[model samples]
Target: MTTSTQIDTERTDILEMLAKHRHFLRLTVRDLTDEQAGLRTTVSELCLGGLIKHVAAVESNWAGFIVNGPEEAPDFSSMTEEQIAQWGDAFKMLPGETLAGVLAEYEQVAARTDELVRTLPDLSVSQPLPEAPWFEPGGRWTARRTLMHIMTETAQHSGHADIIRESLDGAKSMG
Candidate 1:
């Protein structure tokens, strides 16, 4: 096979896997009300709506790293108490937040991530990791690695979401 053909195949495979995982995640929240989506079904704090929001944020942030280097860390010193609290609950849907709104935002983030995967000059492009306790200091990752990471996160959360969905209403994403 030609190099171009191989590259295209690899990209298609990655996109397909990502989409499959995302579909499972979305299916978990299907037909769920706002209250249902926000219900903590398991002992953990994770909820369907919160998982969707968190995944969208994670993908958006990592996609940005493909085009731009690590972003400046938020200045917490100037943050108000409420703002700090909000940051802590970034994954959870706050009052007045709706399931539909979070889902729509997630769709937008997914579209943007698809575009980035399709149009990037090269998947080999690398960027330094952001400053986070979970991330290794001075670590760098290629665009391909970043996409794989997103896929992994989505797939893992899809399983969690599925379990939560089952607990919420005896509904499951798959048999």
Candidate 2:
């Protein structure tokens, strides 16, 4: 490959890494029934379904910090038990939302990310990172760091999703 081609390949690879882990997480719970997706074990109580939901939520969040602007740090302090339960209610199955439903949302988020990466200049563009509640006051993050964080976060959740899937059934590798 030419130098430019190699760089493009690496860029695609990085983007794929961001999407692939979420894909694996989605697949992990796809075959599980409602009851199965909710099954929990030690070390963590999140079920496959909840993990997937969290993945979708977090993806949109990080995407904002990278592609758009700052993240609106989620507000949970005022949530009632019912609302909190809904956030983590893996098996409860929100109206019109199955595993497939959530995956579709994830895909949209990914599509937006692709557009952002294509249109925006390289991460070295030296723009000031957006402010978020978690960001240290005056903190600045490069576009590269933002993308890397997304990939790392997705990888960790994918592992959790795998374990949750195993507990749900005997499902193994996405391979």
Candidate 3:
């Protein structure tokens, strides 16, 4: 296959993986009662709502970084103190946050990223990683790598959500 065709194929695969991961994540939490979604187990501060929020925030960040270059810092500081505190892995879900809303927001992010990737040249062109302190310094990435990393991150956190959900109500993985 030509280089362009190869890039298109890889991008399609990455998007599919991301969609499946998001599907499982949503399914794992979808049937939880409000109280169950909010329950905290002995694991990290993450609850189901928190994991959903974290993935949403990271999707937005990764899409922006890929299209606009690495941000100097994460963009959560503009939020109120409470919002900032709940950013990423913090366990607090904002009032009125719902499973449907969380999924819609992340889906928008994914769509934008997919559009941007399709518009770009083949994935050989590199971009700097997001400037979050958690990432290794000087780690540049391709569009393929960006999508793959998002898929990986989502899959891992979705597992955490599964355990917490199961703890709350004896839920089991569908597969």
- Model 2: per-residue lDDT, tens digit, 91-164? 23455566666667777877877776666656644334555456576776666677777778778888877776
| Shift in Å, residue 3, candidate 1 | 1.3
- Ranking the candidates on TM-score from highest down gives 1, 3, 2
Error in Å for residue 101 of model 3: 2.1
Worst 10 residues of 2 by lDDT: 124-133
For TM-score, the strongest prediction is 1
State each model's CA lDDT, in order: 0.87, 0.66, 0.72
lDDT of 3 by residue, 119-169 (tens): 766666668775456778788987667767788888998888788878777
lDDT (Cα, tens digit) per residue for candidate 1, span 126-172:
99887777779899999999999999999999999999999998999
The TM-score of predicted model 2 comes to 0.73
Better model by lDDT: candidate 1 vs candidate 3: 1
Residue pairs in steric clash, candidate 1? none
Stretches of candidate 1 off by over 4 Å are 72-84
